[model samples]
Target: MPTLSKLVCAALTCLAVQLPAHADNTDGSFQTAPSFSWWSGDKSANNNATGGGGVFGGRSLSVDGLINSAKNLIGLPYRAGGTSPTSGFDCSGFVQYVFKHAANVDLPRTSRDMAQVGQSVSRDNLRPGDMVFFAHTRGGGNRISHVGVYVGEGHFIHSPSTGKTIQINSMDSGYWSSKFVTARRVTD
Candidate 1:
């Protein structure tokens, strides 16, 4: 009988072989460059959830990096229409700055406008770095008025209203949960 180590390696190798096609080049070429080297190789250091081998954007910034960058602003005063760490940030301003810095992606100035783009993601399907939206109306409305970056585990980071600072809050909070709208994945 085969040893357990060999059997496990064989199983992972089979699973890795089923991965779908990947974009070939920087411009997303269709060329197929094939490899499953990670399967049989040492995986002791692999911890990335996406299974891309811990590579963030493969050279661009990773979502974790974006979360870290956003988290660094915690305690920065909230400023309406503000866009920089120095000037502080509103909800949208904070989102804009973090996306620009982390992924080189430019988001709209206001939360509502930012909601228009990107793939629509359900709140239940939220992933780290995904954008969560909200409306000011107590009962919730179609108009989105606030935004935050979902940092996984039902929490998000944002520069809340006046008198608040950039902070992370549980989306499951009574107030937020009631006003919660759909989420979007700009990084996807």
Candidate 2:
């Protein structure tokens, strides 16, 4: 029997023409091409396949790649309106940058606006690329005040606030759990 890698390669070869032109995105990153569709009943939705690993007929969305890219920015400082690695990133800016580069999806600039783009996902059902939202109860109430990328295993990465750098935090922690508002899945 052929190995799983070989089977996957053969399948990708057959589907190459149907895949989008990502020749410039060869560095283990993905770009959004709506032609890409998820396989039905995906058991690996959270698998984090490195080489565009979750598309129809072949690897198409690299959850692992997106996560890794986000991880690489762990020490960057936070700025209110920052968006790039050099200028530092705010909560939403960080999420937008990662999805745009690592996953090839352009998200809205603010966390509140970002919350509106994707489908609602319960905390229990979160996958790796799901955007998690939180609210500051004092001033936020039901309004979203923060956002992060759910990196799986109950952990998420974000630029918490001023004087803080991008860091990963737990979804189950008292602070985040209490403030949790909702989550959205913008990637497959």
Candidate 3:
């Protein structure tokens, strides 16, 4: 009998060969990617890594790899609309780039459009790979100008502003709390 690890590996291998480069966009509607929740499960697996437990078994990589990749850019200068380390990044650009490279998930380019790509989720229910939006410098009811990746533990990773570096921030902080607009789950 195939073990759970073997089954997961076989499934992912089949998915890798069968899944299309882009997710389905039928009926002029976008659906959240079915593999989005894999990020949270990856994190849990890594956190449980103890005594060579082999928590991570399949070809699917861990979210810690994604988070660590993002963390490597901490202190990188911010640039408007930037998407690479050499150029720096805006909030949404940072999220898009990180997910694309680290998790191979393609996201919309702009913050507003990206907000619409995921399922609406409250901040209380946010998990890894979820997107958190904020008003940032924007004011009034038309909030939602900045975006970030929720990396767990009430913290999010984002490219804040010009002259600022990409960094992790607490959602509970007063500045973020006041500016936070909404959170969305783009993955399963």
Top of the candidates by lDDT: 2
lDDT of 3: 0.66
Better of 1 and 2 by lDDT: 2
- Model 2: per-residue Cα lDDT over 27-67, one tens digit each: 22222211222322244544653434544233366776777
Candidate 1 structure quality by residue, lDDT tens digits, 1-188: 99999999667546544544353334222122123232223344222235431233344446666766786676788998899989889999999999888777777898999898778999888877788999875565667999998866566778878987776666785457777877887664
Candidate 1 residue 52 C-alpha distance from true site, Å: 4.2
The local lDDT score (0 to 100) that residue 173 gets in candidate 3 is: 59
Worst-scoring 10-residue span by lDDT in model 2: 32-41
Q: Per model, how many backbone clashes are there? A: 0, 3, 1
Question: Model 3 segments beyond 4 Å from truth?
Answer: 1-61
Report the C-alpha lDDT of model 3 over 1-188, residue by residue, as the tens digit: 99999999668555543444245333211122122333334434333123222122232334565665676576687898798999889888898888778667778898888888757999887766678898866346755799987767676778888877786666775467677888876454
Question: TM-score: which is higher, 2 or 3?
Answer: 2
Could you tell me which residue pairs clash in candidate 2?
Answer: 48-64, 52-59, 52-60
Q: Best candidate, TM-score-wise?
A: 2
By TM-score rank, best first, the candidates go: 2, 1, 3
The order of the candidates by lDDT, greatest first, is 2, 1, 3
Q: TM per model?
A: 0.68, 0.70, 0.66
Cα lDDT listed for each candidate = 0.70, 0.72, 0.66
Query: What C-alpha lDDT, on a 0 to 100 scale, does residue 48 get in candidate 1?
Result: 29
